[model samples]
Target: MKKAIIALALLASAGIQAQDIYTPGEGEGIIYFLPKTQIVVDIIATRVDYKPGEFGLYANRYLRLNNVSTRPETHWEIKDIQVRTAGIPDSTKAYIMKLKDKSLESNIELTDQGIAKAINTTSSYKEEQPEYKLQIPQKHENAHQYMTEDILVAGSSAKMAELTAREIYNIRESKNAILRGQADTMPKDGASLKLIISQLDKQERALTESFTGVTDRTDKVFTFTVNPEDKMSDKVFARFSSRLGVLQADNLAGDPISISISNSSSLPAPVEDGKKKKKIDGVIYNIPGKGKVSVSFQGKIKWENELQITQFGYTEVLVDGLFDKKVNTRVVFNPVTGGVIKIDKD
Candidate 1:
């Protein structure tokens, strides 16, 4: 009997934890696709046109392609491509890197049982390359050979040759020193070879940008999915962005709930523990009715300050040792920083 009670208690606690983290959705869903661009190339043409999709996605946004082009380039070279949706932050956008042929260029093959898995990559080198450029200047050397008898100065005219030899020796010494050091030691991480790599990066970026307005089926595959309804800041999107292409929105229900703050927002800062603070971060339960709640308040407010609550289908419940000595609240936690904004009232 005691074991049964303990099991029941554990089940109840698990339910509450799930409720605290459950995102608002009719039925949680994820969209998956084998996104591919069909590229067309002319036999006699010198260039081929690559066309990818142009639509920016919002949660619940529906897209279907029926008659796409079907031309794959056999002789064409692949450029690593990384792109982002407008109004999305860099911290959230994933970009392609061009260090090697297989560096994070695209991620379209991560679907499981009909769900798109997210893939995340970040660019660490931005703007610093321009500040410091590495250039390896060419050094030219002319080979010279002389007999031992000719090496000794024989007359007044030989003095001019001696002076010229001295200058040549100095130049050769400097050039030889650089060559010897380079031969004995490996290249620095960001010096000569790195400069070459940097040039390749620039070219790759240019190549990617050149295809910005592609209209061909270049086999460029896949895009991310985002939930427009989730109210959490950088957090909500970041969570959805964990695996490569952000989660696809095909499985989302209802219309896109967010408009301007539309798709994503900057996450709320974490409140210090033990600091008396008021927050509204998680779903709230209406005290009057049992409806689940979401707050659209632009900013936090105190009891004396007018706050919008009841309008969003939530009835404020009073609690001890919280706001107003009678807190109108529910669980408030920041999903981005993984911290509770305030202790949920019992």
Candidate 2:
């Protein structure tokens, strides 16, 4: 790929500006490619599924749980959408810096992908991978563990539910007694007290679910990548459904999540000189253009940001004469944006 990019750059430059351009006579030189930005969208969605209890239908009559759903159901909610940018090699912006005359200096450094990083200096680029704290969905606590002997040995679900409800009430009353300092046995420290109260609340909640039913919530992430060459509006990036959660853009069952990108570059358009005669002896790099990216769902904007997009920008030159001075010239480039980071003489 590097060889192909170098060959293409050489051919293109020769055809366009052969008179002014300079190339290494024969031996080795440093070659590098600029980078184009790739936009990444991570859509985070949460799914909540409800499972009815055995006695859910009798909840209102027995335990006064009027809100307990008798039927099982599943639903999804969009949590958030995160946007970020990454750089990839751009073959069209490849360049070669002749090193035949400069024997002592390994002056130019390029990334593994041949994107320029530092000139007359040492540097490295390491892309950091996002770390996700694993969300291992916790298994629902076994309701049987907190069940009383009466509830366990009951002949019917109704009897078991009644016993469980009474047990839940007892646990709640005990917690209240501990909080009020009226329990027979109290903890000596604040930590112990909190632990005791927490355990009681857990037991009560688990037992009460026999009548109120259970809902489990889990999170999911879907990613989409876009490489835009021009302005785009209302592009469907993904879809979402209340019943099926996140879906691909082509899925017809879900609603569309639109993405829009517009060139926001502030750089003035380069003026074309009528004369074709040109001479170039320089290191060329891009002045990355700006782009505004936004995501919309249900006609409301969810996220928006501006990022440096190399494909939208124009190339500029850094004359090779700078390094030929008596003092060494040091320069650094942002490999992602292909823009100069720093320049110094030493």
Candidate 3:
């Protein structure tokens, strides 16, 4: 929890055989575990993607125009649900990708103030004026008017990971100078860094608490339905998507936020479980690949660090089927802190 010395000890007991897996500047933080969703498959073996419904990224603001309170109401299900604790920025302040497909745009319009806007269609353009007013309808042999979309809003993506990691570090750095100044007995740059640090910590803490307080961790759940012909099963699905909620957004920089989703049954068995006495283990993995990984994690503490490093908590496992040969790596993480600790892989 202090510095390199403590981390080194944790490494030794953790027993990770892979390389070091720590980010440079990210400090301690909370890692909120969102509820997991179930995906039903057709017992097939093939890559797949699915989307259940729509998702929105919104910001909250209350205003009193003419001394009258005015803030549009939100869905009762998500009234005042915290998406980004620091408040979402206007279009230019941050990267806003409303929809994934370049051709398709966000159906949910927004005002310059970050409020929802009405959706309307543009008049059909014409190269020439119509000779007469008329109406026409195209006919199809057996076509049904349904709809389709290209983006999987809820699944994990590189952009989402980058945003999450940056936000976590932002929360850390925002309070870094304050703590440093307190130790020196001189304000950071001779300014009231303590006050700033206190404010930032409060906002970060509230954002974090909001994540743990969510009532609908997983909703609109159905199944990870797959192609009827492709073999699909719990074993065959091969974890194609994952997401970890971030409490807020900040401008600070840090390493990419990475995580592996797993269940109790999926955790790896201890190396000598069947033949020898049980030993302490680390509860983290450092996976570099993006495809399916047989992730297993838990903790008993006192885990041995095979990397000859002084890391306090650690464990290792071999990840295979990530394109080709297996990769050797070890990692450890504290759920209470949003730190990945390590995501190393050979």
- What lDDT is obtained when candidate 2 is compared to the true structure? 0.75
> Model 1, which residues run further than 4 Å from truth?
1-174, 177-223, 227-322, 325-340, 344-346
Using Cα atoms with residue i matched to residue i, what is each candidate's TM-score against the true structure? 0.15, 0.85, 0.15
Candidate 3 ranges beyond 4 A from true positions = 1-158, 182-191, 214-346
What is the per-residue lDDT of model 3 for residues 180-282, given as tens digits with 9 covering 90 to 100? Answer: 5434344545346657666556655433322222121222211222111112212222221223211111312211211222222233334554676443222
Better candidate by lDDT, 1 or 2: 2
Model 2: residues with Cα > 4 Å off, grouped in runs: 1-28, 103-106, 124-136
The per-prediction CA RMSD against the true structure, in angstroms, equals 27.4, 4.2, 33.6
TM-score of 1: 0.15
lDDT of 3 at 123: 17
Error in Å for residue 246 of model 2: 2.4
Model 3 vs. true fold: TM = 0.15
Worst 10 residues of 3 by lDDT: 77-86
**lDDT score at residue 213, model 1, on the 0-100 scale:** 23
lDDT of each structure?
0.25, 0.75, 0.25
User: Deviation in angstroms for 265 in model 1?
Assistant: 25
